[model samples]
Target chain A: MYDTNYHRASSVEEAVKLRSSQDEARYLSGGMTLIATMKQRLAAPSDLVDLRHVASMKGISVEGRKVRIGAGTTHAEVASSSALKSVCPAICHLAGMIGDPHVRHMGTIGGSVANNDPAADYPSAVLALNATVVTDRREIVADDYFQGMFDTALEEGELITAITFEAPEKAGYAKFPNPASRYALTGVFVAKGASGVRVAVTGAGSNGVFRATDIEIALSASWSSDFVASVAVDAGQLMEDMHATPEYRANLVKVMAKRAVAMAG
Target chain B: MAKVTLTVNGRTMSGECDDRTLLVHFIRDKLGLTGTHVGCDTTQCGACVVHMDGKSVKSCSILAVQAAGSSVTTIEGIASQGELHPVQAAFNQHHGLQCGFCTPGMVMTAVDMINRHGGQLDEVTVRHELEGNICRCTGYHNIVKAVLSANEEMHGASRQAAE
Candidate 1:
């Protein structure tokens, strides 16, 4: 890793100030991905504004059907949260399935969502649940929050404080994890709520995490695993990598969607 | 340069290192506690696992400055009074090591896993939880046996004492 200054920010305001003060500074939350990226020389910021100590940005709270997860809340915290599990067990289960125990101990919901890795697990939940991304400055709805792979609507120096969403009637996530890295080869998250059925696919989309409208429409009509299985995903729109061909990923999309629907039921 | 201070094992230590120095390097080089190994610096191979503030984390992936003020426990810290920790003893008895390259990380990870899951751990759970820590040797058969045995010994003994 390149030499850089590190500053521990205790509050969102201080974190933002620290970030803006440097020409190239990135918010360090969990540092699961950022640190690894830096070690590989993929990212070399002039300074790192560590947000791990930011008090207001670290927790999970659920009241009735409303759920709010602080950006700094670690995956392990989310996975083990009884309050969150009571209302939204699917999200909790998804959290438990990320990278591994050690990585989950340091990876945060905010960092995962902020990074918006196409293969990341959290974006599927965020998008499928239709959560709202609360930043220091504004609240962006999930639809508007995710722009593309490794891209989001977050402005530079803007920090995500929390994510809020209504507990869906039923929600489940299923992923075909890559054997080595455990990243989602093709993952699907399905949710049924007041807004109706929402299906989000991650790890396969060439354009990043995206809504599977055909499956969503089918599930809304029939609400069955068989319906999901019948919905054909276009291989042309998916990504082809060394691990899987786009056609195989397309098939996995349906298989995982079917499994997700079964799990949600 | 960053002056990083943290409590390693039970000892509060301070050191000066580059801001980019990994916690593993700081522990092994700066503090001269070389038990922690760095098998894969990219974070996949869990040869650098350590307990940070009571949770297992990849020390190689964390910067020394980021760990400042936090309490860390490394492989060197587990033994007491020259007596081997139960996990270490279990590994030794169960023949869990071959090259011994991944033992420190395996032991640290096993300690954390046993702490969290307790004596009720099954083979599947132990194997699943061992996902982060990779062992190319031993085929992980005896390592899994060692973790389970240690878990039972630690938590089961505590349960027996309570009863």
Candidate 2:
């Protein structure tokens, strides 16, 4: 489906240049999503900018209490990284649980977050962690980055370089995956940061992943499962689908939230 | 078409192909390695799993051109000099395959898991790690068994080699 001429970018600058020059140029990370979309005739780009060889686009580093993951880092790399596992086991666990072993090996954090599929696992984790996404042009907080489902604040030719997330005191992510698609039916990431407790829910909401303000407020005060149960999320903000109704999602948000809180403890 | 070079199995090969051609197609069609199968048009199926630069990946979801300058190990590349790779031997001994369509992909994925996790194979980890490769046959009972067996064999080999 991709009839485009391929350009193997040896550096980030070349990739950005190639992306900026073409109207339909796309950055190819692991190609887990882009290649499949191309095979299905869903996306046909005019130029494919290969980012795998860009030397500076891979690694894991810890600066202060934050973990910085390069955009080109694969799910498998993150899942198995000693540094990430030692500091943030929750993130490693979530990375290992994405799709499967093969997908984890090939799929990348940048691609997953960039695609921002409602069912994806990373957005909620990044959102709850209050991560900062460093792009070619600017740095955007997770809250301001994700505009909606499959939408981001990225401008044309913008490419995410790295994502840095503050280490949480205690954090957990629980996802009820769609049996067939392996996408999230309702996923919740609960984190106890230095500021306060943050709760982000994905898959059940039409706006993709978003902070559960009521639950966050309650949890921030008490940081307990019982407190989380008392705060109800309105069903109006939930997404309805063949797998689950909006009311069911509303109910799941409460249950998953409680489970996440219990897990975080 | 682009002149692409990569090491497959242990040998380096160079080929010319369209930039959009998928690695699975190149391996199956151009190279005539049919052990890798395409079960789904989408990236969902791990049936086309292979090792790219020592990590298992869904070959169907990666372009041939992207694989240029990287090392690739397909199902055909795993077994060397007529000796079956440990994962393949385990699959054979355990009767891990039913229709055998997903065997290559399953073996490729199993080897990768063993490489990462070593010999500590639990039912949960095996099931979770095998999420990418789907087997409609054997109910996945033997597939998990094969991975465990491969893990044991590799661990034994490592110990023996170290001794």
DockQ scores for all predicted structures: 0.92, 0.82
lDDT of 2 by residue, A1-265 (tens): 7577899898888899999899988888888778878888899999989888876878999866789999999998888888887777778877877887777877889888888998899999889999999988899999899899999998888998899888899888888888877788998889998857888898988989899989889987888889977886899989998999999988888888888777776
Model 2 segments beyond 4 Å from truth? Answer: B160-163
For model 1 chain B, where is the 10-residue window of minimal lDDT? B113-122
Which candidate number has the best lDDT?
A: 1
Listed per model, the TM-scores of chain A against the true chain A are 0.99, 0.96
Residue-wise lDDT of candidate 1 within A149-194, one digit each (tens)? 8999999899999999999999999999999999999999999997
**Model 1: runs farther than 4 Å from truth?**
none
lDDT of 2 at B99: 97
The TM-score, computed over Cα atoms with residue i paired to residue i, of candidate 2 is 0.96
